[model samples]
Target: MFEEKRSILEPAGALSLAGAEAYCKYYGLKGANVVAVTSGANMNFDRLRLVTELADVGRRKEAVLATYLPESPGGFNRFCELMGGRSYVKDELLCRFVFPERPGALMKFLDALSPLWNISLFHYRAQGETGANVLVGIQVVDTEMDEFRDRANSLGYVYEVETRNEAFQLLMR
Candidate 1:
């Protein structure tokens, strides 16, 4: 048991599975030869939940973002167009926004963007804390980046890209 070998200590649930898969991919090892040690017998729902939550990040599949959009017509639509049209794949984007704290803000946002971008995940919380934070996920094509930025700038919204944020790297990739 003390033999010298490279060992990876992974979490007890979904993250462990993702880690094992990442390891095999990194080493070009076939599943037939690699043994992934994951024990589910001692796992609890809470821990499992946490594992599931982090599994995507562990695999670099999701991203957390903080975007600010104007509280006006077509703002959300412009954002969606910038991201890419709806209909996304697994490796798309997971974006979050801090919406304006005002009447018709949410409606204006949704009305302008829905049906165009396939929202994979959405969460809205009004903390009465100056801005409404919203999280969204969409697919984006790399070639249209300049157009995206131009569209975003024209929308008259203060937006911040958080895909490279430290918290995102630590929690969501």
Candidate 2:
């Protein structure tokens, strides 16, 4: 019999730790000490960048989300309200949004949200189409998640919360 009463096997790679943790959480495994073996002598800059990007997500220390907003007055304000009040260093939130590609869209988005939360990170990927992928990190309190949900729901644009997404953990954890 195995020496340990319980065992879990993880893939041997750069992201073994993140993957193992993700697997355990996905399977709802608990009450046992799990060991992970990660093998890598060195990592290149690209690999290092990728691993850093994914570390937070894999550890559930960040959330990835997408939202749609209208090009109308007060639309952006409502979205900011959904994220709760101003950031106070304690409420750090990570957010991503799919923005409609058009004149002043990016500026409007930032102008509205920056005043509410201390955005720690932002990434914009233009697809040369009608919409662009925008990743944002903000500071918000967990207790206000309900308000976040309500704001997103009524913001008049489609939105999705990707906090528990496996792809996020794998690609940017």
Candidate 3:
């Protein structure tokens, strides 16, 4: 009986009330323990809804922002203030770069981050075609936010953050 129930739950097998009962009986589990049960066509009908519900949970996914900024006076401080003002930012990841046209640009950016903030993670430089842009990606734990935009405004960097929900929806579609 246990074997029969296990077989019913198998992806290739048909699911039915009788099959589910056999499975429960074999496992010595009660019907209340079963969150859902389906057989054949019913399974197909339910699958998408289940997937949609699970996808909804992804909305709580951490937010990550990537920024491109130039090395300049007070630029870093303004960035920090923007992030600091937000109560939801969990951590910052810094990536620095100097355009091939300019030397020592990376060092200056790192120095900027040093005075008031701790870099949770850092990466530097792209392999080729050094542009004036430096990309930084930061993970935010909370969702209620807009301070990052203000921070970007202060720092003069174009920034974008993707919340988990947005990412999930994009992926689902």
Candidate 4:
């Protein structure tokens, strides 16, 4: 099980291939798995591409809070509804707040969240008045996000959706 997990994390390359070859030579390994071998330079280029293109894959695997959204009931609900039924939402992360520095501000913000939605897994507040930016990170499970943009637009939040492929290319290039 551990070997399988590690294999998933391993990059395609000569070292891994060589190791497999050595293991087969010594231990008489037998399997129908196909193997491809390439030079280090080619591997490096491909690896860079994979790293750049799949960076978002890591983000999708783990949720990081984004500092975007206003402190309003309608805003909160719209955000949640936009994220409704996401496949990756095992928890919510709340980091940084740009709301007014007054009593009941935090309460009002919390109240805005629907009970149907899970409590944030992470939370924090901005340091100064000038930094009125609320950062929220939510887990995303579903890769198919056809309605996400529409929902966010309906709620009046400007959002940028970066697919894993595009994110990787942007990062790699």
RMSD of each: 18.3, 19.1, 18.7, 18.2
Which has the higher TM-score value, candidate number 2 or candidate number 3?
A: 2
Off by over 4 Å in 4: 1-97, 138-173
Candidate 3, residues 1-173, lDDT tens digits: the string is 12345322223232355466677889888745553455343345355444334334544533445896669988876887777643333554333333343576555544544333544444343333434545454543334235434444454433344334455336323
Candidate 1, which ten residues in sequence have the lowest lDDT sum? 1-10
Per-model lDDT: 0.59, 0.61, 0.45, 0.46
For candidate 3, the per-residue lDDT at 32 reads 56
For residues 1-173, could you state the per-residue lDDT of candidate 2 as single tens digits? Answer: 01243222222364566667788999999976787676554655565445544555656866778899989999998998788834434455556677877788766665655565566767776544657777666666788667665554544434455545677546443
Top candidate by lDDT:
2
> What residue runs in model 2 are displaced by over 4 Å at the alpha carbon?
1-91, 147-157
Runs with alpha carbons beyond 4 Å of true place in candidate 3:
1-89, 92-101, 125-127, 130-159, 162-173
lDDT of 4 by residue, 17-109 (tens): 657677777887688464655334444444654643454454485355776888876887688668762334353322333555556755655
Candidate 4: worst-modelled 10 consecutive residues by lDDT = 1-10
- Steric clashes per prediction: 1, 8, 2, 12
lDDT of 2: 0.61
Q: Give the per-residue Cα lDDT of candidate 3 at 146.
A: 54
